[model samples]
Target: MVNEMKVAFATEEKNGLDSIVSTKFGRVAYFVIVELDNDKKIKDNYIIVNPGGEARSGAAIKAVQKLLEEKVAVVVAGAFGPNALVALDEMNIKHIVLSGVKVSEALGQITDKL
Candidate 1:
């Protein structure tokens, strides 16, 4: 049986695999959510607008809540706010920082760590 997990990348645009990693986690425009099999190969992927990006306050916390709802095992971004990092840690979700790269590149670099 194959165990599957989800990894979400905070992205600047909704360009699928080519989406650029966002510089800030809380205010990202979108999230490129990828599903990976036990072999750490991508099984599926999709994008969603970040509601937190439109928030007036506590964007980082709101972003973390959205990730939790998506059942993400790992989150990738250029940087995370202190609140976001702490929330992810408390939720037992792993986070990786890979800035100035496409989602595809980020995935390649992180697969081995999964």
Candidate 2:
């Protein structure tokens, strides 16, 4: 089940979502967070991400998870490696993969969809 948790949208800039796409370990598609309509409406709440790496799933999840430690939920601009994915799974946080998209545009799209 998803929480009415606060979500984070990764952005390279403080303004709009940037073109930057970096996961801790892999290429980010987008970063987003959903209030979890029982965890099924993730697709509608996910947004684009702005990261600082090439493609490191572990590192990316680590970074995101670090932020998530307090928030409870996150929508990143990309996906995580098997290891990180498992950690999130165990914690019951939905790790939805938003592969290959702009953070700003993705936010608009996902928000509208949601």
Candidate 3:
């Protein structure tokens, strides 16, 4: 199994070629889980998101909670939604918040911190 103690890095990740393309209007948090012993990673396929609007934080959190059902162990992000936080708490998913950092860079930071 992938490490249960695995950690997820949270950041602002845009799906286009660069960070600017995917999230021009509003930013959404990205999460990636890391395998502790082997240093392997599982990246997201599509964004687990709500309507991608302001004050729609609940959508973000619910999106995350849905992900938790898939057995995600951790969540790394710049910020979070309350629903997501509560769900994470219930599911026991570890969370990390990174501000203004690119997704790849944030992943590196999480790796080092481990």
In candidate 1, list every pair of residues with a backbone clash: none
The RMSD (Cα, Å) of candidate 2 is: 6.7
- Assess the local accuracy of residue 112 in candidate 2 as a C-alpha lDDT between 0 and 100: 35
Off by over 4 Å in 1: none
Give the per-residue lDDT digits (tens) of candidate 2, residues 6-37: 45554443333454434433333334443445
* Candidate 2 Cα outliers beyond 4 Å, as residue runs: 1-4, 9-16, 23-61, 112-114
lDDT measured at residue 34 in model 1 versus the true structure, 0 to 100: 96
User: Once superposed on the true structure, which residue ranges of model 3 sit more than 4 Å away at CA?
Assistant: 1-13, 16-37, 41-57, 112-114
* Residue 53 in model 1: lDDT: 93
What would you estimate as the lDDT of candidate 3?
Answer: 0.49
lDDT of 3 at 15: 51
lDDT of 3 at 111: 63
lDDT of 1 by residue, 5-108 (tens): 99999988889999888888988889999999888888999998888899998888888888899999999998988888898999988999887899999999
Q: How does model 2 fare in lDDT?
A: 0.48
Candidate No. with top lDDT: 1
Over 50-94, each residue of candidate 3 has an lDDT whose tens digit, in order, gives 233334545555455555655666566556666566767777776
Better of 1 and 3 by lDDT: 1
